[model samples]
Target: MSILATEIWENRFFNGQWAVAEKNYAVTEVATGDQLGVMGYAQPSDVEYSAQQAKVAQEKWWALSYQERAQIFENAIQVAIDHKADIIEWLIKESGSIVMKASFETDLAIQALKNAMILPSSVQGSVLPTQNGKLSLAKRLPLGVVGVISPFNFPLYLAIRAVAPALALGNAVVLKPDERTAVCSGFVIARIFELAGLPKGLLHVLPGGAEVGEALVNDPNIASIQFTGSTEVGRIIGAGAGRTLKKVSLELGGKNSLLILDDADIELASQNIAWGVFLHSGQICMTSGKILIHQSIFEKVKQRVVEKVQQLKMGNPMDPSVNIGPLINQRQCQRVEGLVQSAITAGAKLEVGGKANGVFFEPTVLSQVTQDNPIFEQEIFGPVAVLMPFATDEEAIALANMGDYGLSAGIITSNVSHGMQVAQSLKVGLLHINDQTVNDEILNPFGGFGASGNGTRIGGPANVDEFTQWQWMTIQAQAPNYPF
Candidate 1:
């Protein structure tokens, strides 16, 4: 049952005469344990170049104008868009995300590519407010051969989110995608870029898992690193980068929070609450982890939230009626189940959905949860929510900001003053008042604070700069201070 994707062949201008080496395809349905296609192995696959070789390639790349580099990346984005169906289908099969979610992933990737392209031209630096007549200007430039590490969830989106921008900024990219999701990334785009006529080594997909990742991180020629995954791994990689003084960008783990004040509209609150916790079966790093409700409306809102989460249709990714899909794999399912089981044994009541249903872990929302339970402090990456009661606006804010993983926080309230106060009070990078911190847009800066992430995602200007070096040049009019 191999799905054959027609690989486009460009005018192969790199090796003198025109040639053709079309990208092969393989589709493995991870959920069903079905291997649908043969693996496409390049003849010269997983080949490594010396530090000097990498530098030589990088120098040639960095010498190009930003506009030229941006155009090349733009072509690659077009190639991506043309094969949207293949990419989305493969994502659904490999990642076990609902088709709707996978479709959104593809669309978001398109916007991200557009966003990523802009960085090449917009990696600007501010001129320091100099009192003297000095030509002081700072500019951000590429960090040569950039290393990118991606996770299984949203593999294409996260990988290219960094790769597109890094490539546009005249940096060669060596991508190391998650092992389970590597083939999709490795062969999926290899043909696309080949079709787009991107020079070899400008963007290469390295296969394998942790060892491959470690190799990339340790590579001296690799000037920078971009990563998206667990907080523990992010810390280890960040530490590794520090030793070598390499630039690093990370979007790590999150135990997000959501607050519901007394005055919030019940229907709207419940609707948003459902999305807050259940989106992508709550596997998203920014999915609301702890949900605090005002005691005055706790009973009423808790019931509504429970009912809403229960009503959600959980099934196969291909089913249009499915609102939630399976976990990435069995291990994740067990980990999520373990957290809830511990909480239940410790006396937390399962108000609505707690039992595992099929590949889908029932949209589990546990009530009466407190810090006494392990799930309270842990990052249970599943479709679960804890409805804790709060007395005052200050208490709600306090409860919301209590966690160390401050990636995102949500609030549902009509009072502008309270909304602003909570928004200002939270320690998270993104605070959505009257809304859940989900459905991330491509134009916004997506990142975290505290232990969640090391900085920004691909949607913002900050992300592009994180992978670059800020160089300054100044010619002072009055240089009488001290000539070194």
Candidate 2:
């Protein structure tokens, strides 16, 4: 058993209070397989109870002025700032994130909260031209309660990515953080909001596995759903939300492409590509799975990338010098290993590290990956990347679009005009110029195209659209005459 496991898992956050669960499940560290602690296991009935409480709390919360709601979110920023070090430590232990990656996630979550605070001022409605003696206006209203399902890879940021905005928009929230990192995200996040003076029942954190997730999705009280995870799981959540006629926002999977045009600066391109593919071991939705290099620069770029991967330090994430960390679990490590082995069996050449020891996978690079290989077509959520040569600009774009997922894509070119043109042609919701695919901003619209997500975006002023409904109101002193 992990020493921290018993200490951390003694209680679970429920309806803004720390309490024991009906059952407990063990959480282990990925690198050493040591018990970190046991977290609460929420049953289906607990899901129903949470939804009912959220609905009740939302009525009172929604009645407050937008400025009032914004003030509460502003308080959250201070809470996050004050607890930064502790939260980062929890993230590293619970999610197997390196020191830098953990710090980045914690900072991003705080920034998102700040962005959420400002968004209420932007949630404005419009007045329509009147044909009759009537006052007409279209105003946005909260969707009542929101259900947030976040992944373990970015347990804190992904959860707050939706939760902060939903709260700002006057809706209550029921959050289901991934089972693996529930202690930090579930318990600690609830503490952050409570410390910020959010009303009880307005936000409920349920740290659970698939059963809890399924129950939350099926509950009638949840008005909308926001999910970030694998495309396979997103599909199920989307379908369930559809059946319920509930609004759904999905930030799903991605096989993002990093295009190295012939005119690109080799050194700069290699550096960005290395960061994009190896950051957090490439467990992010926007991580570049495919490195599409111009045929003229393929060998040069590949050599630099392989050299960069070789230099990356892979060990305990707690070490500031370690550039890479373990996968979320043994299963993920095995999956990544299996994919690398299968890719090699299908004739792909492994140029660098392709092995796993315990839960740690070495930074791996592959060449000669064919279209038929899964590694080329799917999201290999690991520190693994494949380099492929493209003969022409059209071929490069074609290769980038070959996959069904298109959350993010980027091009590196010295020519700004060419980069802009290619960026316009790409189908992803987010496009980068002279940068890698791994980029995000709190105030920018964040989502993807096709299998990557639904059309709804989750960040910036657009957040209001995902968590609220537009209702047009008209009032007339005298009833208007109909055609009759």
Write out the backbone clash pairs for model 2: 5-36, 5-37
**Alpha-carbon RMSD to native, per candidate:** 4.5, 2.3
Model 1: worst 10 consecutive residues (lDDT sum): 8-17
Candidate 2: where is the Cα deviation over 4 Å?
Answer: 1-9, 481-484
Task: For residues 339-440, write the lDDT of model 2, one tens digit per residue.
Answer: 999999999999999998878899999999878887898789999988999999898888898878888998999999998887777889889998899998
Writing each residue's lDDT as its tens digit, candidate 1 over 98-142 gives: 888888888877787787677767736777766557677887777
TM-score for candidate 2, residues paired by index: 0.96
User: All models: lDDT?
Assistant: 0.73, 0.87
Give me the displacement of residue 461 in model 1, in angstroms.
1.8
Question: Model 1, which residues run further than 4 Å from truth?
Answer: 1-27, 38-54, 123-134, 455-458, 474-484
How many clashes (backbone N, Cα, C below 3 Å) per candidate? Answer: 0, 2
Q: Indicate the worst ten consecutive residues by lDDT in candidate 2.
A: 1-10
